[model samples]
Target: MPRVTFPHVAESYRSFKMLMEDLGNEVILPPRPSKHTLDLGVRYAPEFACFPVKILLGTYLETCPKGVELIVTSGGVGPCRAGHYAQLHKKILHSLGYPVDIVVFEPPRLYPLDFLHNIQRLNPRRMSYRAIYECIRRAWRKLQALDNVEKLTHKVRPRETIRGATTRTYRRVLEWIDRAYSLVEIEEAERSALEELQKVPQDPNRDVLRVGIVGEVYVLLEPASNLEIEEALGNLGVEVERSLFLTGWTRDNTWAETTEGLTVKEAAMPYLPELLGGHGRDSIGNTVLYAKRGFDGVIQLAPFTCIPEIVARTILPRVSEEHNIPVLTFFLDEQTGKAGMTTRLEAFVDLMRRKKAARRPA
Candidate 1:
């Protein structure tokens, strides 16, 4: 099978890769987020599509040869637009003249048994409980560690150098994290990445503006969609913080599910029932958490039609007002541009700088 994988946030890739390898199929990794990717995605995708979805669809077009047999990816189900992504992508790909199997890995929540059965079909070499257990453990640990390191880097001195180093190191580790078959190797990789990142010398004179990014997972993590938000911030001498990174999500939320009785106070359950679905519950908790962290400001990046973020959007103003933090909400669709986003981010950074200066002890 001429298989390919869409790039996602760093931490999720390990578990994704381990599962794929277990299934006895190799996936061609599309290049990481760069100008090249953004251009390709923008050139080929439909006008009204979500940014990340466009990039993913474009990635398949760019990578797959004319005779390729199949493309596979995880898809969601429900009122959320995510559930329809696979079908939309498939239709779009077919219209673009690539009529092949768009094998979707549907959400297990809606079809647990069917999900398992599909996995079994894909990789008949059933994973032993011990093996599955080990992989999950490693993936979680590395993710949490990476999250902690990133958060600390943002608050530290010489923000750009530290942020850049840590990011590069984490990316390197992520690409290789799946190859580890033991806990020790995972631990070693985590330690080595952090140590290398920390060794990047800090500059004393650079004034770093710290800004927080929040919102739907796709727009936040996928660079093709966000126009390299982090890099744009860093270029403007600001340290960018994102609430949707996999490590932070895994640490603040997923840990409770996997480690029974080991709850983290940072992410409390929202009073509102999860109304938007998918990651709705987490967004509620995260909105409150980001407010408490005293970040300069928060930027929410949801797809134009993303319902969960719309719901979160209603709640976030209350969180921001109560905490007195400025919040910028961006609804991104296919038309979002690098220049437009850059201008907005530059303005936000200037606002943060003025706010910080106002409080300086003179």
Candidate 2:
């Protein structure tokens, strides 16, 4: 058994922990978002790598130094740099003198061929079928619970006292959920957490705007990576409805890709016949989903050099044309600053506020 470091603590952490523990390996949760982690990534990774890749690389370096034997992560391939990160990380770690084995779960390209192979590789110890099934069930539960928390947190934050308090509690609940023996227990825990969250008092006058944020997964999750985009939106008197939280991504979207590809024909049929790479299909799906859900607007955040999103950029215009949804795409990099992002966010919020205001009956 190898000591593992699960990077990116958004929503999938618990699921990964359950699966790894089922295989009888010790797992250490990665440190929370911090400058220390970001600095490690910025200093070690290539200049053009996506923020998430850099952060994961930095995490690997730190965890490997602490004696972790294997670093398991999902890798995507296609016309995108995301697919190349695992190999790049492997070389980077080797060059830096870390002996960590990089086990990458290949993302589905044409179908789920690579995905199944990766799953087989992950369970090399040949654990019993029942045990494996249990692990997967636990993982799925963890994802659903975490995603529910994320969705509800965003919906309730503008109406709560402490910002992101629900998110913090959800993390603790995740660790506990992995250990729960039954689904009923998990449901009870969620109920209790939501009840506690509702107790937090908030100002009724606060403007709550349901703005949809779409883009790269890292930018959506890592506050530092995206200059605390969600908080900025919250402060701007708008309720931020993020589109790329990991729990929904891993459980709904990623899991679907593992099989014959889950089709969201009901939601985004007009955007079908187009699958760019990385999250191109998801972007289109989420765009339509957000629009139909009555979000004020959408913000697509991706690294400056992201290819899949660039391709998505073209498709989204057509989506906007069809749905009359306003989408603002931001390309981020090392040069992106908080002040700049805030200014743009403010403008976007102002536009959304005026648009919504016009629709209300006087």
Candidate 3:
């Protein structure tokens, strides 16, 4: 049995791990990213390659020695640099004398053709088509369940009467979900988790500042990659809202692409007014929408040298200036310092607070 491994980009890995287990393939996910992992990625990667490229590259590099016989990776088709990463990583890993076989799946990960092939390729035993399809359905449901629990965390974090209570509860709930044995068990975990989270007691009268986060999908969703910004913002007494989650993004690109006639380009109309891939238009639209919805500020986080977001970065200030909403753009590479990030975030929140105060009628 080949011991296969992949990086945990978010909660998506739990469901993926389950799916592979059901298919009879051995799956070994790399440990959560840390200083060591970041350093591993930066050392071998082309300095200008974006942050996610390093994270995944480093994740594979660090874990390759753990008896991994194969590596499962993903890519996208676009002008954006994302899809090119895995292809390059394969060459780099092979050059380093790691003999592990690397498999690349096109984006959405569960498209009919690629999804089936990925399963068959990784599995040592043959499975019925029904088994393959059913596994995907269950994995997707799990992704939705994870997102629901995460949304609750975002809502409860800022308003929780006790510091860190919501975060602690969220972590325990995640562990509970990971141990669940079935779909019903997962749902039960979610319900029980929500009940536990609600018990944390939020301050109803607390005038918390609200901020919206929008940016490159990986940086926005990967907690370690972003240095856990959501927790930082919540501790700063601000409510956090993110426009993308794993489930929503996969649904839109995989299933919803058939019906999404307007495209992200249309959503960002009159602002960016074009599609540059890597969610450029979506980022622009989210900033405008968040502004109209009374959010005090918007933060755009992305990897350094990310083309799509750099395109958005150029246009976001225009949206900020026009809509009168404060926007902060943070471009992160492995070199980003935590203290500096915290200081900038603190300053942004303070500025938004003063801005909000000025808007009130005397």
Best by TM-score: 3
Order of models, best TM-score first: 3, 2, 1
Candidate 2 structure quality by residue, lDDT tens digits, 1-362: 66776576555666777778777777877666566776888899988777777778777766777877777787675566777788898888888988777777764565477666656656757887687777777667767776666566565666666766655655565565556546677777666666655565667776688877777777777776777777667656667766666555533643243233434433455665655666766677777777766778888988877877887887899998788788888988766777887788889888888988998999
Residue pairs clashing in model 2 are: 76-83, 209-239
lDDT of 3 by residue, 1-362 (tens): 67888877777788888877887778888888888998999999999888998998889988887777788876665678887777788889889988778777875444768766776887676878787777778888787888888987887888988899998888888888788767788789878978888889899888899898989988998899999999999988898888788877532432243344434455579976666778777898877777766789999998999999999999888889998999999998887889999999999999998888888986
Q: What is the lDDT of candidate 1?
A: 0.63
Q: Kindly provide the TM-score of model 1 when superposed on the true structure, using C-alpha atoms.
A: 0.75
Better of 1 and 2 by TM-score: 2
Per-model root-mean-square deviation over C-alphas: 5.0, 4.7, 3.4
The ten-residue window of minimal lDDT in model 3 covers: 250-259
Q: lDDT, candidate 2, residue 154? A: 62
For 55-172, candidate 1 gives per-residue lDDT tens digits of 6766676656535455667776446777777788777778777775666777568888877666554453567657655655765775665566555455442354544664565456
Task: For residue 349, give model 3's deviation from the true position in Å.
Answer: 0.9
Give TM per candidate: 0.75, 0.82, 0.92
- The lDDT values for all models are 0.63, 0.71, 0.82
lDDT of candidate 1 at residue 283, scale 0 to 100? 61
lDDT of 2: 0.71
Separately for all candidates shown, the number of backbone clashes (residues 3 or more apart, or on different chains) is 1, 2, 0
Q: What stretches of model 1 exceed 4 Å from their correct place?
A: 1-15, 33-46, 66-70, 94-99, 106-110, 124-181, 203-209, 235-237, 247-274, 278-285, 310-319, 360-362
